[model samples]
Target: MARTSGDDMSAGATTPAARAEALIRRYFEACNAADRAGLIDCFTPDAVHYFPPGLPSAPWRSAEAIADGWVWCVKTLGSRWTIEKVLAGADGHEAVIEWTHWKTSVNEVLRGDEWYIFNDDITRIIEIRAYYASPVNKADRVNSLHGFDYAGRGYHLDPPTPDLD
Candidate 1:
């Protein structure tokens, strides 16, 4: 079956959370489709986007700038996004999303989270703050970690408890 962004998601975006998620999904889908107009519609006229924690990014000031940013990312830099999780606030005016961005231009995968603050009517995003996560080098930090055993060679988080039925 041929997959499309709009068709991939479920129908009936009735709830505020669902609607917010739908808006975000639509934004990504528009980017995937290279729909410039669609991308601009996802944000408010005076939208703002920021990359926090030392990612040198110019704040996108308006909807046009946001659209241009994404267009440049996808077309010029060859970036793609795969959304992992979306946690909506109780009021449905805010959402935090975990996503993986494949930056083909730099041959890097950025695992990050973004906080989306919706407009008063929940129609579009007013602000987006992104945080990029990076793993610490084993040899860099010398400190006793307070957590589960990390002595044995090759230790990982416990796998899910098996449910043998």
Candidate 2:
């Protein structure tokens, strides 16, 4: 459904964490409804959504792009998502959620966790890093987000060497 209210927050979503959770629920609702505008409203102008390797598009940058991608998935794949759980950080700037994506048309299900970074006020999501619970690709050396700039984003590229006496 299209977003009718400007405020994404529910009535009891007074705290930052609650607001963040509410926004995530709203985002999923938009996705299920194929509401492009509502999906766009959940993210900042330059928000980015990262995906594990294998998907045609690795990362969806910008709110418009992200919205379009999900809308397409719903249309073409008969996609629907269910939020299994959500844990918002105490500070409300970050959250992690477990979800199940059902590709109804293909009769497939994917379980994954997504790490979310919200804007300072917790009203909009700025970044999403998705990790899937799937078997590693034996041929691929690293099963990380395909197009993400790990080093530039300050992610560790190598495991720390062990200190042995």
Candidate 3:
């Protein structure tokens, strides 16, 4: 139950930058759909999706593991994760993204960011390091940028895939 949006593309044009943005959009869509295979396809075999310490799962894990982990997170944890923006790096091998997650149960919004490291082929992610701050006070909150109660708690959703289990 996640809703994702991507910036850096909206002109309805197929520029080189737009192609990169497409990858980000598709990754989020795969997560929302809980398509394990599609999610796996976004990463290399040894891909690492890293969360900060003190989270539910490892701060980092293999690509296959992340597939199941994300599904468990979005489905069981009731997080509606969205991609707010995507910025490709000048190096052309890395990027960082801003994400927002609505923690439905806690009724709060979580704001976070993740750094992406692509594989040698530049078609899949090899490493991802995510950072999230504690829930910012709604009193000082800006318009429509609300966050979740458990948002900044560094929750990790890593789990073993069925085949691996």
Say which candidate scores most in TM-score: 2
On residues 3-29, what C-alpha lDDT tens digit does candidate 2 reach at each position? 212225565777878877888888988
TM-score of 1: 0.72
Distance from true location, Cα of 69 in model 3, Å: 0.7
Candidate topping lDDT:
2
- Winner on TM-score between 2 and 3 is 2
Q: Give the lowest summed-lDDT range of ten residues in model 2.
A: 155-164
> How well is each residue in 120-165 modelled by candidate 3, as lDDT tens digits?
4466777888887553555533213336433354332222122211
List the candidates' TM-scores in order. Answer: 0.72, 0.75, 0.69
Please provide, for model 1 over 1-165, each residue's C-alpha lDDT reduced to its tens digit, 9 standing for 90 to 100. 112122355546667777778777887677655577998898999999897544345787898988888888877756677565677776779988866665556555555678999987788989998776545223532222345243352322121121235
Candidate 3: stretches off by over 4 Å: 1-17, 135-165
Residue 140 in candidate 2, Cα distance off native in Å: 20
C-alpha RMSD values across all candidates: 9.9, 14.1, 8.9
Worst 10-residue lDDT window, candidate 1: 154-163
**Of the candidates numbered 1 and 3, which has the greater TM-score value?**
1
1 against 2, candidate with superior TM-score: 2
